[model samples]
Target: MATSRGEFSSSFGFIMAAAGSAIGLGNIWGFPTQTAQNGGAAFVLVYLVLAFVIGYPLLMAEFIIGRHSRSNPVGAYRAISGGKPFVPVGYFGIIVAGLILSFYSILAGWMVAYAVEPFFKLIGADDMAAWTVNQGNLSRNILFTSIFYLLTIGIIIGGVKSGIEKWSSRLMPTLIFMMILLTIYVLTLSGASDGLKVYLLPDFNKITDAQLILSALGQSFFSLSLGVGTMLVYGSYIANKENLVKLGVFVTLADIAIAFLAGLLIIPAMYVAANTGTEIFDEGGNLISGPTLVFQILPELFNSMGAIGVPAALVFFILMSIAALTSSISMLEVPVSYAVDTRNLQRKASTWVIGGFFWAISIILVIYFDKLFGLVVSFTTQYSQPLLGLVICIFIGWVMNRNSVLEELKKGNPEVANSLFMKVWPFFVRIVSPLLIVIVFLQSLNVF
Candidate 1:
């Protein structure tokens, strides 16, 4: 088994793991709900801009930190900063990633329950609205959650080149292929154009609002798996010769494209079927949160597709579950590998110890602290994530010597003719990205 510093077999494996880390429920559930809340096309346009502008630069920063340090989050910080105050930033990433997994696994458990429900006829009730009610027992929720963690631990204990790289390579492609097929089916529906119009049209006014900007930044940060040392940890596994810029761009584009296409499948189907509009788009509303979406509104949309809805819904959820698991493995791996690296723990022991601790913590979330789950989710998306990202930006932009990082990025593409490195990149990394993140972070706290 590869330890904390295990290397990926190829550039493709690295891309797959990084992309898999990014593509999760955020792409499927979170993106659609966010789009609805802010108005469809307008939010999409702004989100794309943030993805390229703010998001891409930070991604590169993370790559630089990871590759240069060649260590996990904790070690990386100490090595780069030479015992600077930013050490906690890396620790924060580890804690937040684990905290997130604690609650995130519950959502994953819900997917597992929903994915199998159709087969068991548990979700075959006559009324879709009524069917959305809680059929999930707290005990069952915890049980399946434990199962999810076990699977994650099993894969992670197998080592990186074998575990992280191999599994994601298989699973990520399957998820993408299923998404394409689902989009094709969605296009053939009677009112699919309505969804497409809402998703693709450029409505600058709605998206430019400050709150939407905050939300977009949060989504971008989470979608790239950047803020929480996930990208940094993944980056630690790559060889020094790898092209950080090209890899960063590839993963960013893959994430955003998947998110956009997921909107195409979900929004158009909902609008064409349920005539969903602005009211349903409000933040924190039932229409946009938790299983209310995957279980409730989506079932209504699929039902409009006739007999095929059952199978389509199953396939959709199956793909989503895979995506969720793919991301979850990366999240779990961060801490598990940390223990292995720093504490001299065996891989299997570390996986269970970390997985079990988070697993138990997650059960508390689903059973007794359901409301707190929302609060934690809000904190990560709105505050902790961006804060983590801002620190990462500062680390890359100012702390790590520029000559060292640029040299790493320049390995594959020697021809830097007419690039923005001298002008846009440095400013963006130093001023623009950090400032945008700060503004969005304060807005999320309502401090401004």
Candidate 2:
């Protein structure tokens, strides 16, 4: 192994890669859906505050550990584990990352398939288009999931600067561009202004609701892809000369901006769909969420537009596919780095081997989708991630040596020495951030 694995080619490249990992299906679909489900702008307002209060601090904790060790997430944790039991927290994180990718690829596969569906339709191959959208078709699910895995693996095989950074630098801007164009298009339609009203105008009464606040906190956490070693791995790749404080703020802001921008598109489009007489809200008056919103409701909104609808759906799914791929590449990197670091494997071989393992798991989940899918998602994301995040705060806050942590940050920017972040973070990550994560964890227990 090279003494140095590799570094991101530039600061912009690093920012895009890190931000891309943060801005996934969650930002595109999950954020907006949560906004609609709660009291729209109220959720947005709370989520924004928590992004800085909760998300950025945890994010910095990962970056500090990551660059300090200059190793994989497991390796980084092991370097600081101080004991055996804590080591498993490192192992558990990659497991969560793997399980997350397994199901994540399945969702992204649908986006990939949906992106392709319009092509078939445009060519008059309506049957082929229908086949692509048919989730019950085992062949369809397997094929697209495989395609997504291959795409991720191909990028990984190219090494850090050439692969992950290069693609992220390209895809993130494209994703943003598409979101802007789609938002502008949707806003021009009749009734879209009503959605704009709901999305931008906060209902402070609901903002105080315990459940809504918890939901916003959870969205804030998960939207950044925290608790997974993905950020840690990305941090390990960051340059010593890069000012991580500025970089962290940049990535956090990018994530919030994109997720907020997605709300601009998604909510308004839902109202526009409602104007077309499509049932955008359920019997309880909550906006349709999860797979139903992406696969069914939004498609209805797109299709109601007549001739341009096919291409419109095409662009939207392509946008979703881009967002999904950017995140998947980062998730896949966690295990790939572990394999390379621990198993002494070649990065090329490791990407394929590890990606194939997750792909097989995805295939298995697709086969037993109804039974296993929800179980794995909840098990990995809901339970495992927050617990792992708790470990991160504990390690960075209470466990790791303070001088050592500052030494790492100093490598990137010496001025970080007396910064306000230095003044607040130690205490915040120690007491406040952990307490907030505990609240989020408790909320996940079905208590509101």
Candidate 3:
């Protein structure tokens, strides 16, 4: 058997590292978009409940399995199941992490490119559309994507404590501080109240829609980084003295809070743009989504701030780059940890070997984004993630020994092991969480 892997030096480091994994573009971009579409505060309310109901228990399940096995995702499952047929679930998770990192690195590259735009004098262009198009040039995308992957690889080579935990400890707090400052500034703009009302006020009529609930469920699940083996890998790094239940709650809350703060910034900025006669919505009057909202809409909004827009835009993109780095390090670490633990590779060697492979894959994604990006994204998010999440829940709930899981829980918190949480969580994972994940899967497939 492999020797025990390194553990996080402190609980604070563990929580920040885990929260860094959870609070990525999914929180910064995906969450706000989902909220805007699914009735804002109504969607937010549903998402919070689901974050606890589905996200927290499943997070704890991953923690239990990881700490119990003291291994990466694949070894964790194998150890937990006594090398049963369920080992393939762990392999599936590793694959999911690889696929996600491939595309995610490319997107992070765009944030990097954007962050440097002001310094390049590109932010002052007369035609924002032309600037946007030029920024999407294939050569530029490849260059920045390569740089982003290099950064990710460099950090992984430094090992967990020196690389992931150290950077996450620094970046997460800076991301929050920048967000708070930006939120205050954006709120002072004219027409900001309109966006605030839309974001913070519940529209009961829209809350009744089936699609809205499914959207919130999916966002909550994805936002927590549950299905990608990220939490599983991070959980392995956590020390036994940490309370898994409490840590999960705090991480979930931090993730939600950052996402909510993003809404406060983005939504109000959009309304401010609209007040200045920029078209902040599409022809259908829906808030623009995806890349348009991030690259085009937000830039246009910032430009409307006159000279102040330059610094604001720089700060925003830097914030995005920091968020991307935090998450990418975690994704890269999953496979790196596996190679080191299972394959007996040195950390530097494993980081370079795996990093080179994905760096090439990320180039393909960048160069052929128009042809492959949407298809890959849909397949991963809609099919792979939900399936993987369901499998994990099943493995922990039904396949792993109940006594073993309770033992892991007791290591973290003896009180929790004997509480209603222990009684309810297993059943919830086995029955309720899986059922809800299936619903999300079906909804993704439009089978509903």
lDDT scores of the candidates, listed in order: 0.77, 0.89, 0.83
Q: How close is candidate 2 to the true structure, as a TM-score?
A: 0.98
Q: Candidate 1 — worst ten consecutive residues by lDDT sum?
A: 126-135
Candidate 3: regions farther than 4 A off? 1-4, 122-133
Worst 10 residues of 3 by lDDT: 124-133
* Candidate 1: stretches off by over 4 Å: 1-4, 36-39, 81-83, 122-136, 204-208, 275-290, 303-306, 410-419
Q: In model 2, which residue pairs have backbone atoms overlapping below 3 Å?
A: none
- Please provide, for model 3 over 1-448, each residue's C-alpha lDDT reduced to its tens digit, 9 standing for 90 to 100: 3235677787788888888899998688778767887898999999899888888878888887778887888888777655467677778778778888999988888888777777655435535434433655887788788889988888878787888888889899999999999999999999999989888888878877898998888887888888878888888888878888888888888888889999998888888888988887788877887777888888888888888987898999999999999999988888888898888889998999998988888888777888988877887888998898998888888788888887777787888766888788878899989999999999888898
Q: Which 10 consecutive residues of model 2 have the lowest summed lDDT? A: 77-86
Candidate 3 pairs with clashing backbones: none
Clashes of each: 2, 0, 0
Better of 1 and 3 by lDDT: 3
TM-score of 3: 0.95
- After best superposition, candidate 1 residue 430: deviation in angstroms? 1.1
Error of 2 at 163 (Å): 0.5
Best by lDDT: 2
Tell me the deviation in Å of residue 263 in model 2. 0.4
